[model samples]
Target: MAENMFLFWGSGSIPCWKPMIVLEEKGFGGYKNKFITFSNKEHKGEDVLKLNPRGQVPTFKDGDIVVNESNAICEYLECTYKDKGTQLIPTDKAKRARVLQRMHEAAANMQQKLVLDLLYYFFQTKEEDRKEEEVAKKVEAAIEELDRWEAYLGETKAFVAGPDFSMADVWFYPIIAQSIRMGLDLGKFPNMKAYYDKVTARPSVQKSWPPHWKEEPPMISPFKGRI
Candidate 1:
């Protein structure tokens, strides 16, 4: 059996979903999950803060090692579990460089934009408190970056970095899925819409999304498949 693993996560959070998707894709078994509640300030509590000083969701514990940062968690899984399943970060130097680049872009750029938009619009403390103009600007920037992703897809096949699904896709999928949930219409970008549909249909994604999330109608649907 695999070593005992624990993941600290919040329901429907993109960062949390990244590692969860990686774990499912790696087919690692025997892991435990602790669901943190943002509403209750569980993430900011002492116990979780000890593991993640930033007080972020998706902290990971494996044996004596505790890791925070979603990308770092995913990278650790790839290296530690390299022999367990399909290689996520490519072995080739150039290919791996491209994969890592895309992963960073998705994390630093795309996810940031989506998070800002969601914070301003859906999760704002008051209806009037929502930053309508700022949200629109951020959404436009996000769409521009998403257009680059679509172009990247057009140049490649099957996955983001290359022919096979890699960590880049894992990083990208959850952000897009959550963005869709926040009412970003995918119809404006057909390629991205198609790519989003393809990723959400994966069994790994289906498993990563919380059960409660399934009850809500998808805010955006680029394909017939339910996410």
Candidate 2:
């Protein structure tokens, strides 16, 4: 079958993985996925730059319509292909609102504070030169925020938003998986750990797992010593 869409993506990128998971859940298995490498700055090359001036991965094209940003692409797919495959956005009004709320929280709060802040400490600082106090506080704050999500999961007893798999799971899974790559202890959050096992067991998530991660060692957290 001919591809209905084209996805420009980078391996192991949380943002890029979002739409890919959506596509998988949508079961558009024949769609094209063009892998770009940050090492060679391939995303910055002419083709991708023309599609997305920012030259970011997760640049999506379905015929003449192009979309950027992970969440936007997921939303577009959910709306555009709603009748075809798995329904990512819930049909019930209250459930839909909950999914959307968690989606935004995943991006605005969890991704921003937990993922990016720790990444800044890791990539931007050398071990010998690291500031112990400041990094420790950031790590602690991230864990505290994560614990809140853990509590939510324990209460909800199903997926991120509720009993069904929804956009909230799509948004939450990648960041948490990447944090696992960075050595965030899911063991500290039992409900989150159980949730992790359930999500990772999904065929879509397994298919979308970062290719490079299988070949690489778990990243040593920059706050390893402090924590």
Candidate 3:
């Protein structure tokens, strides 16, 4: 059924991981996928450029239909095959709202604001250009945000939005897992650690696990303090 569906993705990319998980959940686990190496700049090649001008993986093609963004691809799969496998988006109105809220919250806050913010301090800045004091302040702000999520998970003890593993968990599990892989210190946030463990154990997550991560571990933390 997913024969014409093709995905150009990068290994260990959190955004790239999302749609793969969605495809697996939607019973399209056998969809054609080619890994694009980031270091090799393959994403910028003509294949990806034709589908995604931004040169990003998760340049997905469903027959002639193209969806570039990871979250949008996941949404497309869920909407296209709502009844095939897992019901990612909940049916209940309030529950659906919660799922959507958490999904985008995870995207904007944890993934972009917190994770990428710290990553910029490391990958984007030269050591000679480092500002210790400024980076420390950013780390503190990130810790406070993590604490809010920790409190939420500690209170709920199920999924990000509720008991059921819905689209919110699909959207969120990778943030927590990838954050830990990138050295967020699951030890600092025990509740989030538990949440990560719970979701990581799910079949969809395990099935779609980044192929590269198995062979090479992600860069570890130089900053381990919880702040």
For residues 81-134, could you state the per-residue lDDT of candidate 2 as single tens digits? 888678999878988899899999888888876778876677778878877687
- Say which candidate scores most in TM-score: 2
Which residue pairs of candidate 2 clash? none
Q: Rate the local accuracy (lDDT) of all candidates.
A: 0.77, 0.85, 0.82
The clash numbers for all candidates, in the given order, read: 0, 0, 0
C-alpha lDDT of candidate 2 relative to the true structure: 0.85
Taking the tens digit of each residue's C-alpha lDDT, what string does model 1 give over 51-89?
A: 889888888998789988887889999999887766889
TM-score of each: 0.85, 0.94, 0.93
List the candidate numbers ranked by TM-score, top first: 2, 3, 1
lDDT comparison, 1 vs 3, better candidate = 3
Question: Which structure is stronger by TM-score: 1 or 3?
Answer: 3
In model 3, the runs with Cα more than 4 Å from the true position are 220-223
Sorted by lDDT, highest first, which candidate order results? 2, 3, 1
lDDT of 3 by residue, 1-227 (tens): 78989999998888888898989888888899888899999999998999899999999999999999999999998898888998999888998998899888887887765668876567678778878887888787788778878887877788888878888877778866766666677777778877788788878889889888889866645345533
Candidate 1 runs further than 4 Å off = 1-3, 117-122, 129-132, 216-227
